[model samples]
Target: MFVLAVILSLVTAAVFAAAGLAKVQGAKQMRDAAAHLGIPWDNYRLIGVAELVAAAALVIGIWLGWLGVLAALCLTLLMIGALVLHNRAHDTVQAMAPAIGVGVLALVTLLVRIAA
Candidate 1:
């Protein structure tokens, strides 16, 4: 359980960090996504910051199980919001899959950390 938790946490952190950095750096894709989702650029950047913070927490949580749990939960919620926005935009299932997948990873991380 501990090993699983560590693996999941690292993978989730990597994914979120990459995504967050893209948003923070104002990548073309992220900007387009924000516009598509009707989110303001500033608000989208703040969301990116939130992701980065959560990712950092997950990394730091390697030795601190509680923080890992909290970070995973946060990521899960973020993903939920992403899903909602995507849905509101009438996005295809394929377009929403990333959020669903990452949300599952975050959820699994949370469960594993708790078990560990």
Candidate 2:
């Protein structure tokens, strides 16, 4: 269970880190992507930064146990919001994929952590 939790945490963090980096470092591309999801570019940089921080927290939280749970919860919410924004933009495919994927991972991480 502990091993599962660690693997899940790492995977989740990596995915989010990549996504966040893309958004933060690749602003123009991210803005275009956000436009597809109906998110204005105005605060995208901030969002990206938050994502990066959250990703880091997830990794750090793994050692702290409870912090890992909190990080997972935060990421789950972020995924939800992203899904909502995508849906609002009529980007059903894009919205559903990451939302569902990340949500499932977050849930799994939560379950494993609790079990451990």
Candidate 3:
């Protein structure tokens, strides 16, 4: 269970870190997507920062059970928000897949850690 949790945590951190950096670096697609979602530019960047922090917390929390639990929960909530934003933007299911998948993984990790 611990090994599984670690794998999931690392994967989630990698994905979120990449995505957060892309948004922070002003990737055009991210910008356009945020605009399409009716989110302000500043808020969009803020989301990137949040993702990065969440990612870091997830990775760090692996060594700190309480933090891991908290980060996973937070990431799950953020993914829920992402799903809502994508829905509002009327994005294709393909575009929303990552958030859905990641959100589920986050939930699983949180549950696993708690069960441990």
Q: Could you say which candidate leads in lDDT? A: 1
Deviation of model 2 at 59, angstroms: 1.2
Candidate 3: 10-residue stretch with minimal lDDT: 107-116
Q: Arrange candidates by lDDT, highest first: which order? A: 1, 3, 2
Score every model by TM-score: 0.96, 0.86, 0.90
RMSD of 1: 0.8
Error of 2 at 75 (Å): 0.3
Q: Weakest 10 consecutive residues, lDDT, candidate 1?
A: 105-114
Q: Candidate 3, residue 57: CA error in Å?
A: 0.8
Give the per-residue lDDT of model 1 (tens digit) for 8-115: 889999999999999999999999999999999999999999999999999999998789889999998888889999999999999999889988888888888888
Rate residue 66 of model 3 by lDDT: 89
Backbone clash tally for model 2?
0
Off by over 4 Å in 2: none
lDDT of 3 by residue, 1-116 (tens): 89888888888888888888988999998899788889998899988998899889989988997888888888889889989988988889998997889889888878886876
Sequence-dependent TM-score of model 1: 0.96
The true-versus-predicted C-alpha distance at residue 70 of model 1, in Å, is 0.4
What would the TM-score be for candidate 3 when compared with the true structure?
0.90
